[model samples]
Target: MGDDDVLATLARERGRALFGYAYLLTGQAHAAEDLVQEALVRTFARRRVGFTPDSAEAYVRRAILSTFLDDARRRQRWSGVRHLLGRHDEPARDPAPAVGAVLDVRAALATLAPQERAAAVLRWCEDLTVPEVAARMGLAVGTVKRYLSTAGHKLEALLGPLPDDETVPLTSGRTRP
Candidate 1:
């Protein structure tokens, strides 16, 4: 398909799902929508990534993730500059109580370093295997495994223990604690 055609089809077929994933990462409706649209332009129109139709969604998902992380880092740097200039905003309010565990998990996920968060989300949320996540994130399998390990400990520290079913799988050369 041509660039516009491919983007049109992806938006028609996967738009809601893509927006939902972006929303989970960003926690804002307008930002989520904009992120998905931006990802489409970068992935398809710009041809920044080579892809087959079968892998298009995965590629786009990675684009969304990378874009989100990039924006986050940019915002953090800008915030630091503002702080240095003696500007401050009031502390933000906590999430509504009704949102509870999901929000807590999201908050915990935010506390993680980027690589750990990406590894944990891909392995546990996206249900990718170690080797698969390694390929997706362009890291070695051992590195992915270590990221999962560090993310697990960090998450457990922040949120306490997870249920057995929620635990990440140990790598082949590793054993569970």
Candidate 2:
């Protein structure tokens, strides 16, 4: 069959399934519909060699996932720079908390043992994985973990508890400890 025939067949037979998949990903009926429509447009934008109904549906589903992920990444990037889009630059805000927090952290680090301080710095500041921190310090993994745990406790006591779910790494090759 031709491309238009394949597209028509897929939309007639597999449209509900595609909409349901998009709904699962987006979690909103309107958003799901939009995603499905966008995916359909993107999938059929390029000419395909031999696209049956099933294959066309598969391609559309893949396009939906790609569009969703791309949108999420774009939103994240936009959020980081969105402040610059506004014209209001308030000059009355105090900037000392940013400076004070750095001093406070430095002071807290001074109180920790040398090994504990080193582990904390490598793991949090350097954004190294547990194994990487251990390798850099010439210590065992368990040893590095222990030092980090102790250092975390010490820092928390001084700086107050960090957010329970906050565990993003700055720049690491693998998962953060």
Candidate 3:
């Protein structure tokens, strides 16, 4: 196959996984899609005259990581201003009864620092080992462990104790009796 055909085939096979990875990083589906597209575009632009498939996947993954890190930094810079605008102006709606558990998890996740959130997502959601997460996040294993521990503690505090009953409401604002 021609070089373009090979590239297209590889993208077709890996695009969904790439998007999923991006979503894990950004926590927003639309932003994740945009990140994946931007990463692919940047990777294609910097493509070498003769690159192997093995090298290409590594390159793409690196590009995705760079994009996510850069985007995080940008968001951090604007977060203070965004927070000042406040959430009170937002529209209200009925909460999803079934998704209360999911929303509780998301809220707990939001309370974590960015590195902690990333560490938790990489370790749990992505099923990456501590060493693997450290490598991917460019941190030491000790640092990753600390981040994960901090995240777990914060989640426990925010979520409170788990009830004996598995069917207990996660966000119903009621303590187990």
Candidate 4:
């Protein structure tokens, strides 16, 4: 098949799944779609370099992740202005409890150092294994474990125990919320 044919076929098969991956990372549907579309466009443009089928998916996924992270950093830099201009439309579902819970978690998370926060989020929120988290964050296994432990201790002090039904899994250990 020609390069265009191959790229089209890959997009036809993997586009939705790629968008879903982006959505998982971003927690925003429109942003995820935009990220995925941009990644695909970049991939198509680079097809002249002869990307293989197996590597194409990984390439696009990495691009999407990098794009999402870059956008997050940019948004953080301009968040004050964005918040001032943004609408206050709430989610379709009642997000009060969820928002409160997330805010609480975020507040507690902010107490930890950057590496600790990244370790905890990767282990708990992303449900990645310790090795996987270490690989992604480019930290040693021991360092990741230490960060998790430190983060867990701080969270425990800040948030206290969870209710019987609510469970929180941190990098170091799991706690009942």
Candidate 5:
């Protein structure tokens, strides 16, 4: 199949999984859908040869993650100077009833820094190893480990005690920022 066909097939067959992955990272359905669409556009924006459905999916998934991380970084940067822009915070509203039990986990996740949440999701939900998560996030293994440790602690405080496997042994010695 041609690249277009491959992408179409991937979207038709694996759409839910792609959206679910994005949703896990975003914690909002609309945001997750937007992420997936952006990733698909990014993945296919340029013409390329020999893209299979599997490869297309992989590329889209990676794009989704990178886009999410990039957007998070941008939002973090904006937060620092947003008050200077004279924009007032909107009044908080109750979450929709559909949010239900997932609210606790999503609320806890919202407390984590973007990188920390990504690390936790990649490590625990995706079941990737520390090194693998590091590779996916383009961070050093030690950095990923530290992120996991911090996230684990924060998540535990909010969600109650986590499982024993949540801990990551930090390396001794100073890390250069």
Candidate 6:
């Protein structure tokens, strides 16, 4: 199959899983879609000699992880620089659906260190094993476990009580009650 054909097939087959993974990693719908799109574009933008179509999905996923982590680091650095500049500005507009059952959960997730949040998402939401998460994140397995544990503790404090397993659904595709 041609490169485009291969990518299309992968999207059709794994789009939902990919989207869910992005959303959990990102905690934002629009950003998640953008991340997925960017990953796809980067994956197919150019195919290397050893990059087989069968490995495209894995490649896109690795790209997504890289992109998300890089963004988190960039934002952290920018936040510090902006602080030095005394540019403490609030968001210009309120978030849509400002109140919902999942808002607390999302807010709580947002408070986590980026890597910790990523570890929790990969383990619980994406249902990946610790070793799998470590491999995806290019970290040692022990570090992944530590992140997951730290995230679990913080989430429990913010959420009151939560399951050790993945209790929170990745997406909140419903009207606020």
- Provide backbone clash counts, one per model: 0, 0, 0, 3, 0, 0
Error of 2 at 139 (Å): 70
Estimate, for each residue in 1-177, the C-alpha lDDT of model 1 and write its tens digit: 655666677788888999999999999999999999888777776563445554677878999999999999999999878867653576655777737977888999999999999999887777677898999999999999999999999999988985563365423333334
* lDDT (tens digit, per residue) of candidate 6 on 1-177: 678778888899988888999999999999999999999998889866555556888988988888899999999999878867554575555456556646887898999999999998787667777898999999999999899889999998988866644444444432223
RMSD of each: 22.8, 14.0, 22.0, 19.3, 23.2, 23.8
Residue by residue across 8-54, what tens digits does model 2's lDDT show?
A: 89889998999999999999999999999999999999999988888
Candidate closer to the true structure by TM-score (higher is better), 1 or 3: 1
Model 3 TM-score, all chains together:
0.42
Give the TM-scores of the predictions, in the order they appear. 0.44, 0.48, 0.42, 0.42, 0.49, 0.46
Note the Cα lDDT for every prediction shown.
0.83, 0.88, 0.78, 0.79, 0.87, 0.82
Clash count, candidate 4: 3
In the range 98-166, model 4's lDDT, one tens digit per residue, is 789888999999888999999888877776778988999998999998998888788888888533223
lDDT of 5 at 20: 99
- Which tens-of-lDDT digit does each residue in 36-55 have in candidate 5? 99999999998878888888
List pairs with backbone clashes in candidate 3.
none
Model 4: lowest-lDDT 10 consecutive positions: 162-171
Error of 6 at 103 (Å): 52
